[model samples]
Target: MHVDVKELKGHPGAQRTLSRTVEAPSGLGTVLVGIAEHSDLDLDLRVESVHEGVLLTGTASAEVTGQCGRCLDPIGYPLTVDVMQLYTWTPEANQTDGDDEETREVTAELTLELEPVLRDLLVSALPFQPVCRADCPGLCSQCGFRMEDDPGHAHEQLDPRWAALASLADTLNHDDEDDDASS
Candidate 1:
């Protein structure tokens, strides 16, 4: 996804549009809550010269589909990004005429890399925690049963060790409450 600056230089203030279907990379930051699958992007990039730097302004939109984090349900979400970036061929310190007593140096070749920028924009647009529904009941902690699908299900703890601890804690809490009430 690298574009030659020389091509853009010829068409100053001209707009170039592109469309690409890209696979979402696998990583911690690249993984969306419910949108990690392949995405199709429609990009509109405009190349313009501004204050001696090349500026690119555009919009990118894509549809992403993946599994929900809470219930593992399939979900689809729309991702949109508005990006503005600047590229300068002239070195930063050499931009000022008086500051540089020596001759200005200009490179014949300049290229702009778009792969990283596109990846970041799409990843950032994703939701932090995506749920299948707004009021998902999630799963029961005791038995690992999905509570949303089962309302009347009762989870029984058969472990005597855990049961004894729970009972003792309840008894101690009751005694403290009784003492407080009496006092």
Candidate 2:
């Protein structure tokens, strides 16, 4: 995913279109979701010459697949990210403004490594907690039951302070019933 910017270097306003589909690099996602390895990564970009260096702007798309973070169900979707980056001709080109932002540099051979940039953009766009759908009910916390199967599923919960009293009351009721039967 390296682009040769030799022709565009130092030639302000010179631009070229870069359109290609390449295999996605490994580790292009978070633990929850990411682009599949060796999947198709389509890059439709425009490389323009600028005074600072080369400016790249366009879009990159790929198929994103992984399990939902909440329900653990499988999920798949297409992701498209807008790409806009500037490769500075010199490290000092961006230092004049005292900005602390990272700057991409064009190599001495006039090549720009596009993989890192794409990886940063695409990976950052992934959701931290991916879900199969917006309203996924997920699983029940108490018994690990799938809540989607029955929304009203629940267990009778008694206050710990009253638990002893409840058992005593049940015993008393049983004793009363037995006495009535004997009478």
Candidate 3:
């Protein structure tokens, strides 16, 4: 996503609207969800010429698709992130005495690369734990059963100390029943 600012460099306040659809880039999301590569990405932005360099401000939107972190169900949604950045006219001008943030720089070739900037904004806006829905019941930890299918599903767990005795008692009862049937 490179924009040429050749004409806007010398004149401040000369702005132009940048509205177009481009292919989505890779790594634009977390492990659970993200925008697919080569997918449609809509950029609606304003590129203005400033005295220092160029100001890029607008929104970038795309469809995010992935599996839910909890239930592992397929999930998708549209995500739009705000973009605001200023590229200084020269690399040397980006250095400031007390500013810790790295300044954006317009290239010597009179072009601005928007990919890195958009990646930062979009990735930060993505949820760390993506969920299919707020009320998703997820899966049963013990059996991996879908909890939403049966909300009251459960397992009868026996105490480890009494498990052997319980099995013995069941075997004895079964033997007695077998003897009675034989008689």
Give the best candidate by TM-score.
Answer: 2
* Number of residue pairs clashing in candidate 3, backbone atoms closer than 3 angstroms, sequence gap of 3 or more or interchain: 0
Q: Arrange candidates by TM-score, highest first: which order?
A: 2, 3, 1
Q: Lowest lDDT 10-mer window, candidate 2?
A: 94-103
Off by over 4 Å in 3: 157-183
Task: Give me candidate 2's TM-score against the actual structure.
Answer: 0.90
Greater TM-score among 2 and 3 belongs to 2
Write down the TM-score of every candidate. 0.63, 0.90, 0.83
Using TM-score as the measure, name the better of candidate 1 and candidate 3.
3
Q: Scored by CA lDDT, what does every candidate get?
A: 0.63, 0.92, 0.90
Candidate 2, residues 34-107, lDDT tens digits: the string is 99999999999999998888899999999999999878999999999999998999878878746676679998
Q: Give residue 124's error in model 2 in angstroms.
A: 1.7
Q: Write one digit per residue (lDDT tens) for candidate 1, span 1-114.
A: 555566556455655555555555443133435235454556677756444556767876777776666666777867778966666557763565453233222244666666
Error of 2 at 19 (Å): 0.5
